[model samples]
Target: MSDLLERLRGRGWRLTSQRRVVAEVLDGDHVHLTADEVHSRAVERLPEISRATVYNTLGELVCLGEVLEVATDGRAKRYDPNAHRPHQHLVCSGCGAIRDVHPQGDPLAGLPQGERFGFVLSGAEITYRGLCPECADRG
Candidate 1:
């Protein structure tokens, strides 16, 4: 069973066949898939699964704080299942691939007191953009 399935079961979330397939499709490291991508994969597992079902399941997962919605390119929002862990993103400039990155120290520490402008800091998202080895090698 995937971590997502375990979490969902622990929370008593109803796991229909369609929902289970959707969750299964999303299980993996550095997995950031858009709704369409998830739907496509879910359909492969369960031929009758509907796109709306996948979208709804994704929305519910996001609402439950079990998944993170990432808007990396301003085109489509990708769903990330690693919501419990604190991390940033490393995006490939050429291929748009995203990887989870854990940098040392507090990210907020980099912002001086005056720079805060009086708002409380909850978290920060720092995305490092560069070409992956595959893209770099292609050049």
Candidate 2:
């Protein structure tokens, strides 16, 4: 996480206290959190941080390529700190939980060239949906 901070600092990011707290909350594991979730967590560390600050920090991170914005569904978008890696997402239909996954094969190749409709494709995402183990066990 320090590496990320240093990179941002080298790029002229101010690294304010609120931004630092937001970064701390985002670090570690394959964290997929919404802005509200981030704000909720940030409040635990810096109770005075506002939702607007967290949102702006997250947006700056996204613009800097330090984070990935994932829309697994119609709900709030999720922030993924594992932006430097290539992976897909697995969603729990029952609980709305999200997981990062690396599936085998090139998903982009499956799309026929003729169907592209002239727009150049840069990347693709696949979202697999199903009931998680705990949710399935509840049946």
Candidate 3:
């Protein structure tokens, strides 16, 4: 996702070496990495990268709308880069694995007009939980 990094650069972001490392760690399809997990990976690349820096960079990325925070349940939040696409998440209840899934229709349509409470809703997030193939087979 050099494109994302380049966009951030064009926006006049600091683009510190630590920020660049975190961005590269999150650069992928269907990658839902938690802040701790991200820090862990970043530490491998640059041992001096502090947790605070990672958290700050992630918050900045989210503010820029380049990253989506996927909180699948009440656990650790995962960072998603598929912000340009409209899709939902399929989470594994057993292993905590996450996948990007495009459902059949508009999920927001399920909210009937009567339940709207007189407010215009623009978007919706739906989380589907189930056992992944590997987890299911283990049982």
Candidate 4:
């Protein structure tokens, strides 16, 4: 069983065949796949699986806080299974490839009280953009 599957099971989420396949497809590091990408992979394992099922399962996962929806560079949203972990993203500006980055310190700490406009902060998201080695090599 993958970490995602384990977590879902722990949360008492039903593990149907379609949902299992979708979860398996998302079980990996730096895995940031769009819904279509996930459906493509799920279809390989479960040919009977429909795109709608994949989409619905992804939506449920996101709502359950089991997956993170990432919209980078105005491109299609990607589903990340590293929700339980604390990390941000490092996106390759050239290819749009994403990697998980665990930077030091609290990101919200840098925000000055005056700049906050008096709203309480719960969390923050920071995306660092640069070229990956493959993209840099191509450049």
Best by lDDT: 4
Taking the tens digit of each residue's C-alpha lDDT, what string does model 1 give over 37-128? Answer: 99999988999999899999999999999999999777589999988888999999898889999999999898999999998999899999
RMSD of each: 1.3, 2.1, 1.8, 1.3
lDDT of 4 by residue, 24-116 (tens): 999999999999999999999999999999999999999999999999879999999999888999999998899999999999998999999
Residue lDDT tens for model 3, 12-80: 988789998998888877889999999999999999999999999999899999888888668899998
Every candidate's lDDT:
0.90, 0.86, 0.88, 0.94
Shift of residue 139 alpha carbon in model 2, Å:
2.8
Ranking by TM-score: 4, 1, 3, 2
Clashing pairs in 1: none
- Total clashes in model 4, counting residue pairs 3 or more apart in sequence or in different chains: 0
Candidate 3 ranges with C-alpha deviation above 4 Å: 1-3
Instruction: Output the worst ten-in-a-row residue range by lDDT, candidate 4.
Output: 1-10
Which pairs clash in model 4?
A: none
Listed in order, each prediction's TM-score against the native is 0.95, 0.87, 0.89, 0.96
| Tens-digit lDDT string for candidate 2 (10-110) | 78888889998898888866688999999999999999999999999999999989888988668789988877777888889887888888998888888
Number of clashing residue pairs in every model?
A: 0, 0, 0, 0
